[model samples]
Target: MQTAKRLFFSLDRQTECVADYIEPDRYSFLEQLPENERYIPRGAGLSYVAASFGSKSISLGLSKFNRILAFEPSGEEPTIVVEAGISLHKLHLFLCPQGLRVPVEPGHPQISIGGCIAFNVFGKNQFREGFFESCVEEIELFHPQKGLLTCSRNENTTLFELTIGGMGLTGVIVKAKLRLKRIPSPWLNVQKIPFTDLHHMFQVMKNESQTADSLHSFNDFTSFGKGLGRGFVYAAAFSEEDTAPELLMTFKSLERKPTRRFALFNRLTIPAFNAAYRTLNTRLKPYERMPFYRFNYPIAEMSFYFDWYGRKGFVERQMLVPEAKLDPYIEKFEALLRKYRPQIVFGSCKFFSGKQCHLRFAGTGIVISMEVMPNAANQGFHDALDELNVHMGAIDNIAKDSRVTKDLIASEYPEYGKFRDLLAEYDPHRQLASALSDKLCL
Candidate 1:
């Protein structure tokens, strides 16, 4: 047990203070904090690098607070009130049966609703459904000072908007009432399309989602740009009619291991994975009736999947580029990846046009994500990445440097400062401010 009532650091990914605890237990812990004491809320510990690290404050771990509080029937927009600590994966189990779902889900479901709401998470579906925030009708907050505050789209509208993508700086999200979608039996009618490179591929995707379901695309560094690293695409839509439940599968015998070790932090093995994946996937064009979870989050064992990068301590870099600049940016991005050749284990890219979030990262554009070993002597490549990030055509730099400059935030998010101001009204004493809140410059 960490034996001090003082600063107890917790972290995830790689950092000094990786927190542990789910939402249920975390709720209990927060209610017991030293009165008026400063604390940061954390869930799943899946912030990629160090989103939850904090000093001079209690690290409120909400891992155990997870629970499907209440879920209603699907006749009139099935809805559920969930503990903030509940993982999105578990949430799916509750809704999948009714063919209902939260409109927006990130690539992986291990992320907690507390985190997702704070980040105002969006997905390929956003071209249609918007973001995870859109699925949320209301949220309940627990403040160190205030006992409990109920906020909803209709009641406390400002609180609701600020809490979305607010990064837990506003208050501890104890519970949330999220709207669920009616589906055709928890199956995704999926399609896989290949592009010579980024150009034709991205174009087709944007057009498809304009009138279709969710979509996500990725560039195989081993297949496109002077290499075999072309692009692989996955587009999915819910079925119109109910389908039979998928036979429950098991990973224990499936053998979906990533790899034992890295030969070097270069691009050799990655390209091979890309080639093999593309070959097998090419045969899967217009695949149909897949389990929704499989289609949404490829890594079904999300808890275990997150740990895969840890065997070697990895980091992910994500960038949101506006639609107009996506083509030119892809040209440069592909060249940069080829030249650097960092051992990118896996990655996914997708688009979104969500409700404007103060300091929120997504906005009617493309978000590219890549996982890599942080200390693989890849500084030269990392430097190039930094340069590209600095000059990416239309991306709001607020997403990249939210920690450094508040001005950049006002520039990109436009309303971020207002969000912070509202946050101040809710938490004037700065009791809920977190390392992420500080970094997001909110």
Candidate 2:
């Protein structure tokens, strides 16, 4: 019912568009659309690239569809049926009161559940519980051509898999039934382990995988030469008896601030900052218990974390390499980091297991994610990344990929052609499309 110019931009503030129309409504929103008009569904707009941007078509905004249709707190198989527009943070608040929680906790808490499913997002504990899709019991999708269709493992199996990591290209996800886990307390028993090098870190990660419920490692990318791979590894699990007094303490959310036009992170600033950060970590206690929000969603607490990248913003590059190739691949990757010396603001390491969906970014390997600030002078950084992808046989995470080509995707994801065929069958007329789909020729 609203008529206004809609400007869509990615999280990194790199790609943007001014769309003709943006309709925000209930399930019937698709019915009013004009025939043969292309549109892309939007959630929290968390994709690092232009996946949800519609330059020449309508951008279907689903924020108004926020509603919880059903809630089952106590049962053998507890579940919650929620509208796609509901943010994960809201859902967490709702579930925490009932002593239940969703296992998959992506870093961004404000992201909508629909966006999480579209990306099949990975969590800190992906090494144990798998991607967010693993918690999905069923979904309700509205196809422009086919109308409403319910999909799950028991029915419409193919659509279920496709929609899980389909990047909203398959259809408009209206509702979803997510499985929930019962927790004794909303806190985590955290253990901070520091490592001097890549080999030591990987060894610790492998050893901790068997006992830890969640694991994530921070790398000091600014460090060069002998101190190259020095950083901290965090292993944590939900507290059972509220035994740690530190975990009971509440921490206020950090103040929100507007992004400044000036740059906060440059080549010189990053090295010095990282050096200090590493030193500060060394002074902290090896073990500490903190609230669940502090351990799982720390970045969410800092509302202005992304603003540090400045107005030019940054691109997030993520790739997954098999476990067998982890050692050598990381060694060479470190060399590339030294050669390019791109201004890296944030970096993390995670382990992933279980079978990967056709389009989902999951596998039995290690995932390396880095946020880099690029300028006109850093053209070689892009080339070096492309070469590294080829050399390491890395799989491109569709959500974070900006420079990946169709050929590179085909070379890396062999199941991509089959996924395309399935998408064609479901949306034969191509009623659903996005900038990402068009860029990778999906």
Candidate 3:
């Protein structure tokens, strides 16, 4: 009875779209409703830019579909069956104690299992492993046309391939059987490396990635021209709990920080923090103790990091350039940055081995993502970046914008047209999207 139109909120209110929230436990309620052909189910609504968006009838929030459902504790498979709406944070808890981990997790734990699969997400270990889709054992797809169907690598191989990173366009991922990674312990042994400049940072990452079990960088290109590549790299690997395990905090204990406290003060913190933050040398810094949850995506602390960008909303531009172009791309991007002085506030480079993901963005190359805080002062600079396709020209690469217009977006990822075609065939009526979906032609 609760329709998405009655209770909806767009991820970015500036965009015109309303999601119909639905609890995972209420399956019967949805089944009873008139089936919508174009409806796309979404979780978390954390897809800041709109990757999981729909045009006509958006399937609302499904994060409550959070049941452990089934798991093979000692079975030969070593896998777990979970409802798609579970958060990555919760999923990690179930796996950690058994010396297991997720093969792919985005930069933040706030994302849901369904979101990860829809994006066919990737992570720090991508250089060696590849996208998150490789580890998924199977998925239960819900489509109005097909009704309820099973899709997996072994069974619905074509659909399975298309679903992973297909951006939820193929079908609604109701449940998934994900293969878990065995580990020695839930703890992580991580090292923080702060570079004084861009060259030093790139030089170190290329070298360390060869051995670091998993690596991620927290870098700033904001000063690229004025020497802004100075930043830190946090590389971590699963280790036998070397540190005291008391640092781990449970979900019930974790709470959202007060954003209101920083509202008036962030104007000063942005520049001041970056100044001191850029000067510190990371090499001299040694390894430190860290919890697995904290180590992977620590930025969870600054929840409002993106929203802090005032009126001129910021866009996160991400791409994967061949390793050989790592330094070249940095040089070229920085050159463009210096020319534009656009805010490259926060960025990261995670190594990956090449492979075609369903939506196809992360791959065997250098994966760089930046938080672009554009304003009246930086519009010209940001516009230049929107026009720069140099990386695609120099290397086998692609760029993705969760909020980008359909025309510009499809142009960036040629395979997107193919992706849309698959989506159309699967859901012919188009009852599952929001306004953004219609505008993007997805």
Q: Which candidate is the best by TM-score?
A: 2
TM-score of each: 0.83, 0.93, 0.86
Model 1: per-residue lDDT, tens digit, 263-319?
343455556766677778776543666777777776655445544444344655566
Using lDDT as the measure, the top candidate is 2
Error of 1 at 8 (Å): 10
lDDT per residue (tens digit) for residues 23-48 in model 3: 44566655654664456677776665
Q: What is each predicted model's overall lDDT from 0 to 1?
A: 0.65, 0.79, 0.64
Question: Whole-model lDDT, candidate 2?
Answer: 0.79
What local lDDT score does residue 224 receive in model 3, on the 0 to 100 scale? 45
Stretches off by above 4 angstroms in model 2 are 21-23, 243-260
C-alpha RMSD values across all candidates: 4.5, 2.8, 3.6
Clashing pairs in 2: none
Model 1 lDDT-worst window of ten: 249-258
